[model samples]
Target: MFTKVMVANRGEIAIRVFRTLREMGIRSVAVYSDTDRDALFVAHADEAYSLGPGLAAETYLDVGKLIAIAREAGVEAVHPGYGFLAENAGFARALAEAGIVWIGPPPDAIDAMGSKVRSRALMDAAGVPIVPGVTEPVADVDAAREVAERIGYPVAVKASSGGGGKGFRVALTPEALPDAFEGAIREGERFFADGTVYLERYLPEPRHVEIQIVADDHGACVWLGERDCSVQRRHQKLVEETPSPVVSDDLRRRMGEASVRAATAVGYRSAGTIEYLVSGEEFFFLEMNTRIQVEHTVTEMVTGLDLVREQIRIAAGEPLSVAQDEVRPRGHAFECRINAEDAEQRFLPSPALITAYREPAGPGVRVDSGVRAGSQIPEIYDPMVAKLVVWDVDRESARRRMLRALDEYVIEGPATLIPFHRWLLRQEEFIAGGALHAELNRMADAPTPLPPADGAAPAQAAPGDEAPEPAPQAERHFTAEVNGRRFAVALRYDPPAGGGGAGAPVPAPKKRAKRSAGGAAGAGGATNEVVTPMQGTVLRTLVEVGQQVEAGAVICIVEAMKMENEVAAHQGGTVKELRVADGQGVAVGEVLAIVE
Candidate 1:
C-alpha cells in the first residue's frame, strides 16, 4: 500500500476516500477551495492543502495547481474521487508524466470511453449492443434528419463529449429535430467546449442500469454486478440501487460479461462503471464512467467490496484480490443522493448552512456525509450533501429500510428530497417496480410545488443602499382550516407611510396551540407555521415589518450541500412575519413563513 494519497476532490467523496485510506493504514491528503476551508473532509484528512478560490475552475479543476500541490505534499499517488478531475484524461496523463501514481484507469481507457462517439464505435466493434444512431458527428440538419430517419423517430441529439446530462436533447418528432440538434450543439460547445454532436435513438421509459467492473494491470478483471439508477431528473441520477428489480440474474450476468469485455478491450485497470440504457429485456451501451461512481456505495453495500481500496491497490500494481467467481452481488442495496434540493419544486438546488445535522442509523443503513453542525454549504459546487445507503436481504426489505431511513433523517438546513423519496416509496407503481423513467412525469400528484405565501410582496430599495424596499401590504385576510376546525391567525401588513406596521398587528401566541386550533384560529394574522421548501439553514430573512411579497417571490434562502436556492412564494401574498432569522436550522415543510 502507498504511504500517502492526495485526494483531488471535495465533499462526501473526499471524506469517503479518506476513511478507507485510514482503514488501510494509508495517509490521506485533502485539497479544498477557499469556500471549503472549514469542510469536514479537510479535517478528516491527515494533511490538507488549499486549492485557491471557491469556483471549480479555479480550484478543483486547476490541474496544474493540483499537480503542484501533490508534489509539495510528497504524495506517492493522487486519487481523483469521481468528479472534477476524476474523469479528466488529461489530468490522469499529466499525473503519470509527473511520476505520481494515478488511482484510476489508464489514460488510454479514459480516452477510449471518455468521448461518447468514440465509446459507441468501440462498443459496436466489440459486438456490444449500442443504440442505433449516427456513428459520427452529424454534418448538418439534413444529415441529422437522415440519421434520425434510419434510427427511427424520437432520437436524441447528444454532444460527443458530454456527461452530467448536459449537452443533450430529445426530438420526439421530425418537427423537433432541427431545434434539438442546434440546442444540443450550443450546449455542447458551452459546457464541454465541443460543438460536435451525434444522434441516437431515444429509449423512452428506459431503466438506467450500469455494471461495475474492477481490473488489475496484471490482466485480471472481475465484474461486481449491476446497479439501477432509473430514478433521475433531467438525466441526472437521484437514486441508485443494486441488484436491480428490473434486471434478472441471467440478464445481470450477461451485462456483466459485456462490461468486462468492454473493459478488457481497452486494457482497463482500476474501478470503472459501464452505463447502459435498458428497456424491457433489451439493453444498450450508453457510456463508461472511468472512475469510482457516486452510487458506488450501493454496490459496496451489496457486494461487500471496498471499491476505493481496490482502486488504491490496483494503482500500487497489486493483483486482483478476488477471482471473478468470488465476486457475487448478494441482497439488495439502495443509495439516495441526499442533495440540497427540494423535491417538490422540481428538485431545485437548496443550499444553506447546516445548523443541526442528524443522520439516520439502524440496521442496514449507512450515511456518507461530509458535513457537521455549523458547516456552511458553499454555493460553488455540486448540491449533493451526503449519500444515504441501505442494504437488505431483498428489494422489498431494502425499500422499507430506505423509507424508514429517509423519514428518520433529520437535516435541518437546506430542504432535501426526503418527502419526495417518501412519496416515491409509497407510490403504487414505484412499489410494484413498474415505474419507468418517464412514469414519474406522467404521475398526476408529483408532489405539488411548494405552497406559496398568502400575502407577500418583494422589497425594493433606493440606489446605493443595501436592502430592497419592503413589499407593500395587501388588504386580504388569510385563514387555514386544518382537521375541520378554524382559528384566528393574524396577518401583518406593510406599514403606512413612515415604514412601520400600520396595516394589521401580527398576533403572537403565548404558547404552542393545537394543530387544528392553530390552523383555524389564525384568520387575519400571519401564523407561526413556517415551512422550509427544502433542507437547509436559513441564510437570511429578506422580509420584515410592513414588507410585502408576491407569490413565487423569494422569502429566504435555505442552504444545503453548498448551494443557495431561492425559496419562492407559492402564491401571491404579503409578508406576514419572518419566522426564522439568519442561521436558523430548518427541516423540509417546517414552515418558513405565514404569508397572508
Candidate 2:
C-alpha cells in the first residue's frame, strides 16, 4: 500500500477518503482553498496545503497548482474524489507524467467516456443498449432541430461533455427548440467549457438505476448490485437505496453482467458506476461515472465492502478480493443527502453559518459529515453538507430507519432537506416503488414548516410573562455570524465605579452592524429593492438601466453553489439603477437593482 495519498477534493467526500486512508495505515494529505481553510476536511487530513483563494478554476480545479502541491508533499497517489477534476483526463495524464500515482482509472478510459457523443457510439459497438439519439454532435440549433424532427417530439438537447444534470435541456415541441438549444449550449460552455451538444429522445418517465462495478489490474472484475436513484429533484439525486424495491433477481443479474462488460470494454480499473435509464423491462445506458460515486455509501452498507479501501488497493496493484459470484448483497440500505437548501423554494441553495449541528446515532445509522456546529456552508461549492445512511433487514424497514435518523438529525441554520426527505419517504407513490420526481415542481410551491432557529425556542412568552432581570456583575454571552463565517463572543459585566447594586442594568454596547428581524437592513419587498435571497455571484444582469419591466420579471441570474437562480423583479417599473454587473459577488439581501 502507498505510504501517503493526497485527496484532491473537499467537503464530505474528502473526509470520506481520509478515513479510509487512515484505516489502511496510509497518511492523507489535503489541498484546500482559502474559503475552505476552516472546513472540516482540512482539519481531518494528516497534512494540508493552501491553494490560495478564488473560484474553482483558480483553486480546486487548478491542475498545475495541485500537481505542484502533491509533489511538494511527496505523496505517492492522488485520489480525486467525485467532483472538481475527477473526470479530467488531462489532469490524470499530467499526474502520471509527473511520476505520481493517480488512484483512478486510466486517462484513456476517462477520455473514452468523457464525451456523451463518443460514449454512445462506444456503448453501441460494445453491445450495451444505448438510447436512440444522434451519435454525432449536433452542429447548431438547426442541426438539433433536424435531429429532433427525425427522433420525433420531446427530444433532449444534452451537452456532449456533461453529467450531474448540468447541461441538459428538454424541448417538448419545435417552438421550444431554440431556447432549449441555446440554454444547453450556454450551460455547457460555462460548466464544461464545451459547447458541443447532441440530441436524444427524452423518456418522460423512467426509473434511474446504476450498477456498481470495480476492476483490478490483474484482470479481475466484479459487480456489486445496483442502486435505485429514482428519488430526485432537478435531475439531481436526493435519496438513494440499494436492493431496489422494483428490480427483480433476474434483472439484477443481467444489469450486473452488463456492467462488468461495460467496465471491461474500457479496460477500466478501480471503482466506477454504469448509470442506466430503466423503463419497465428495458434499460439503456445513460453514462459512466469514471470515479467513485456520491452514493457509494449505500453500496458499502449492503455489500459489506470498503469501496475506497478496494480502490486504494487496486491502485496499488492489488488483485480483487472477492469473485463475481461472491458479490451478493444483503438486506437493504438507503442514503439521504442532507443539503443546506430550501426545498419549498424550488430547492434554492441557502449557504449560511451552521449555528448548531448534531448527527444521529444508532445501530445502523451512519453520518458522513464535514461540518461542525460552527461550520460555514459557503456558497462556492455544492450545497451538500453531509450524507445520512441507514441499513435494515428490508426496504420498508430501511425506509423507517432513515426516517428515524432524519428526525434525529439536528442541523439548525439554513433550511435543509430533512423535512422534505421526511415528507417524501411517506408519499404514496414513493411507498409503491414509483419514481416520484415528476411531482417536485408542484411540491416546490407547497407551504412548509421553517427550520428551527439555532436550537432555541421562540422568544415570545405568555401574555403576562416577562424575562427576569440580569444580576449585577454577572457575565453573559452573545454570538453572531457574518458572511457565512462563524463567531463566538462573550459579553462580560463589571459594575461601573461604586454604587452598583443587584438587578442593575448593564449599559448596552454600541451597535456594530445594522440588522433586522427578517434579515439584512434593505431586503426585497413589494415595491423596489431587488434583493438576492442568498449570497452568490451575478452570472448575468438581464435588465439594463432605464429598461421597463413587469412584476416578477427575471432581472438577473445569480450563481450560488454551482447552481443558477433567477432573481426576479419585485414589482413592475423602469430599471432606474442597475447596482450589479456580471461576475460581481453579492451578499444575502444585497440589492442587485433599483426600480421605480
Candidate 3:
C-alpha cells in the first residue's frame, strides 16, 4: 500500500479521503488555493500545500502544478475525489509519466467512457441498452434540427464530455433548437474545453437511477445495488437513496448484469457508475461516470463497505475481497445534499460565512461535512456545505430517521434546503414512493416555509425580517498582499440584538410574490424589473431591447456555482430597456432588464 497520498480536490471529499487514509495508517496530503487557505479540509491533512490563487483553472484544475506538488510532497499516489480532474484521462497519463500512481481507472478506461458520443457507440456495440439517438457528433444547428426531426421533438442536446448536470440543454420545439444547440456547445467548450455535442431522446419524466460497480485488476467486478437520484433540480441531484423504491429484484438484476457488461466492454477498473434513465419497465443508458460519485455514501451505508478504501486497494493491484454472491445489502439509506442554497429563491446559491455549525448524532446517522463555525462557503466552488445521511431497516423508517436528523443538523448564516427536505419527506408523492418530477417542480416554484417565531430552531433561513440583508450588521473585505503574495481578508462583526452595529445579520429576502415596483427581489413581481436571483455571469440574453414577450418568458440565462438559472419576466410586455449584455457579471437582485 502507498505510504502517502495526495487528494487533488477540496471541501468535504478531501476530508472524506483523509479520514480513510488515516484509518489505513496512510499519510494524506491536501492541496488548496488562496480562497481555501483556511478551509477545514486543509487543516485535516497531514501535509498541506498551496496551489496558488485564482480561478479553479489556475489552481485545482492545473495538472502540471498538481503533479509538481505531489512530487515535492513525495507522495506515492494521488486520489481525485470526484470533480476537477477525476475523470481527466490526460491527467492520468501525466501521472503515469511522472511515476505516481493514479488511484482511479486506467487512462484507457477513462478515455473509453469520457465522451458521451463514443460511450453510446461502445455500449451499443457491447449489446448493452442505450437511448435511441445519434452516436456521432452533430455538425451544426442545421444538423441538430435534422436529428430532432428524425427523433421527434423534445430531444436533448448534450455536451460530448458533460456530467453531473453541467452541459445539457433541452428543446421541446423546433423553434428552440438553435438556442439549445448553441447553449450545449458553449457550455461544453467552457467547462470541458470541448465544443462537441450530440443529440439523444429526452425522457421528460424518467427516474434517474444508476448502478455502482467496482472492479480490480484480477477480473473481479460486482455491482453494489442501485441508487435512485430522481430528486433533482435542473438535472443536479439533490437527494439519493439506495435500494430504489421503483427498481424491483428482477430489474435490479438486469441493470446490474448490464452494468458489468458495460464495465467489461471498456476494460474498466477501480470504481465507476453507470447512470440510467428509467421509465415504467424500460431503462436507457445515460453516460458513465468514470470516478467516485458524490452519492457513493448512500451505497456505503447499505452495503457496509468503504468505497474509497476499495479504490485504494484496487489501485494497489489487490484482488477483490468479496465475490458477487457474497455481496449482501441490508437496511435502506438516504443522502440529502445540504447545499448553501435557498429553496425559496429558485435554489439560488447563498455563499456566506457559517456563523454556527452543528451535526446530528445517534445510531445510523452520519454527517460528512467540510465546514464549521467561521467556514466560508466560497462562491468559486460548488455550493454544497455537507451531506446528511441516515440508514434504517426500511425506506419508511429511513425517511423518518432522516427527518429527525435534518432537524438536528444546524447551519447558520446562509439559506439552505432543510425546510424543503422536511416538507418533501411528508408529502404523499415522496412517501408513497415513485418519481417526484411534478412534486419537485411544485416545491421549486413555491415559497419554502419559515420557522415559527416562538424561538424554535430554524430548519432553513436565519431569524431575520423579509428584506435583502442591508449592507450588513457590517462585513467588510480587504485584500492584503505580503511579500508578493495576495490574501483575501474579511472582517465581520454582528452585535447583540439592539447593538444596531455595522454587522447585524441582514434580513432574508421577501417571497417572490410580494416584490413591488422599485424594490430588489429574486424576480419581477408587482413590477416590470426583471431581476437576477444570484451573483453570476450572464451566459446569454434571449430577448432584445424592444422585443415583445409574454408573461413568464425567459429573458436571460445566468451561470452561477456551475449551474444555469433562467431569469424570466414576471409579467412580460415589451423589453423597453436592456441593462445587461452577454458575458457580463451580475449581482443578486440586480435588474437585468425592464419590461413595460
Candidate 4:
C-alpha cells in the first residue's frame, strides 16, 4: 500500500476517500479552495493545502497547481474523485509523467470512452449492443437534421464529450432540431470544452440501469450487479437502488457479462460504471463513466465491498482480492441524493448557510455528507450537499427504511429536496416499481407543500378567543471585524411562551441603501433591464449596444456549475447598455443588459 496519497477533489467524495485511506494506514492529503477553508472535509484530512480562490478554474481545475501540491505533499499517488479531472485523459497522463500513480483507469481507456460518438463506435466493434444513431459528431444544424432524419423522429442531440445530463437535448420533431442542435453544441463547448455533438434515438420511457465493474491490471475483473436509477428529473438521477426491480437473475447475468466484456474491450481497470438504457427485455449502451460513480454506495451496501480501497489497491499493482465466482450481492439498497435546491421552484439552486444539521442513524442507514451547521453552501460548485443511503432485506423493506431515515434527516437553512423525496416515496407509481419520469415532472409542476414545523402544538382556545402570547427571545452575541473596524452583532430567536408584554428594545445598526441589479431607471425613468437568473460567468455576449432584438432573443450565455444557460430578452427592445462583458462573474439578479 502507498504511504500517502492526495485527493484532487472536494466535498463528501474527498472525505469519503480520506476515510478509506485512513483505514488502510495511508495518510491522506486534501486541497481546498478559499470557500472551503472551514469545510468538514478540510478538517478531516491528515494534512490540508490551500488551492487559492473559490472559482473552480483558479483552484480545483488547475492541473498545474494540483501537481505542484502533490509534489510538495510528497504523496505517492493522486485520486481524482469522480469529478473535475477524474476522467480527464490529460490529467491522468500528466500524473503518470510526473512519476505518480493515477488511481483510475489508464489514459487510453479514458480517452477511448470519453467521447460518446467514439465510444459508440468502439462498443459496436466490440459487439456490444448500442443505440441506433450516427457514430460521428454532426457539424451544424443541416448535418444534425440529416442525421436526425435517418435516425427517425424524436432524436436526441447529445454532447459527444458530456455526461451527467448536462449537454443533452431532445428534438421530438423536425421543427425543434435547429434549437436542439444549437443548444447541445453550446452546452458541449461550455461544459466539456468540446463543441462536438451526435444524434441518437431517444427512448421516451426507458429504465436507466448501470453495471458496476471493478478490474485489476492483472486482467481479473468482476461485475457487482446493476442499479436502477430510473427515478429522475431533467435527465439526472434523483434516486438509485440496486438489484433493479425489473432485472431478473438471468438478465442480471447477461448484463453483468456484457459489462465485463465492454470493460475488457476498452482495456479498462479500476472502478467504473457502464450505463445502459433498458426498454423491456432489450438493452442498449448509454455511455461509460471511467471513474467511480456517485451511486456506487448502493452497490457497496449490497455487495459489502470497499470500492475505494479496491481502487487504491489496484493502482498499487495488486491483484483482485476475489474471483468472479465469489462475487455475490445480498439484499437491497437505495441512495437518495440530497441537494440544496427548492423542489417547488423548478429545482433552482439555494445557496445559504446551514443553520441546523443532523444525519440519520441506526440499522442500515448511512449518510455521506459534506456540510455542517455553520457551513456555507457556495454558489461556485454543485449543489449536492450529501447522499442518503439505506439498505434492508429487500427492495420494499429498503424503501420503507429510506422513508423513515429521510424523516429523521434534519436540515434547516436553505430549501432542499427532502419534501420532494418524501412525496415521491408515497406515490403509488413509484411504490409499484414504475419509472417515474413523467410522474416526477408532474409533481414538480405542482406546488410542494411546506413541511410542518419541527415541533408545534395545537390551539388551546376557540376561534373567538384572543391569540396566544409570543414567546420570550434568546439573544446570542458575536464579534467580527469589517474593513479594520470591530463590531458586535446579536441575534434573537423567539420561542413559544404565555406572555403578551413587549420585549426590551435593542439599538439598531446603521443601514446602507442598496441598488437593485437592474441599475438606475432607464430612459423616461422606465427601466427595462435584463438580469441573470443565476450566479455564473458570462461566457459570451450575443448582442452589442443599440442592437435591436425581438422577444426571446438570446442576448448572452452564462456558465454556471459547468452548465451553460442562455439569457434571453423578455420583450422586443434595443440594447441600450451592456453592463457585462465576456468572462465577467455575475450574481443572481445582476443586470446583464438594458433594453428600451
Best by TM-score: 3
CA lDDT, candidate 1, residue 175: 98
> Which ranking of candidates, highest TM-score first?
3, 2, 4, 1
CA deviation > 4 Å runs, candidate 1:
442-447, 450-596
| TM-scores of the candidates in the order shown | 0.77, 0.86, 0.87, 0.83
**Of the pair 1 and 4, which is ahead by TM-score?**
4
Across residues 327-372, which tens digit of lDDT does each residue of candidate 2 receive?
Answer: 8788999999988776644567877777667789998999999999
Greater TM-score among 1 and 2 belongs to 2
What lDDT is reached at residue 528 by model 3? 78
Error of 1 at 121 (Å): 0.8
lDDT string for model 4 (149-205, tens) is: 888999999999989987899999999998888888877887799989999999888
Ranking by lDDT: 3, 2, 4, 1
Segments of candidate 3 deviating more than 4 angstroms: 442-529, 543-551, 571-577, 594-596
TM-score of 3: 0.87
Candidate 3 lDDT over 232-326, as tens digits, reads 98788989999999998999999999999999999999999999999877888898899999999999999999999999999999987778998
Output the worst ten-in-a-row residue range by lDDT, candidate 3. Answer: 498-507
Question: Candidate 1, residues 16-74: lDDT per residue as tens digits?
Answer: 99999999999999998889998899999999999877567888999999999999999
Candidate that beats the other on lDDT, 3 or 4, i.e. the better one: 3
Q: Which stretches of candidate 2 lie over 4 Å from their true place?
A: 444-525, 546-551, 570-574, 594-596
Report how far off residue 565 is in candidate 4 (Å): 5.1
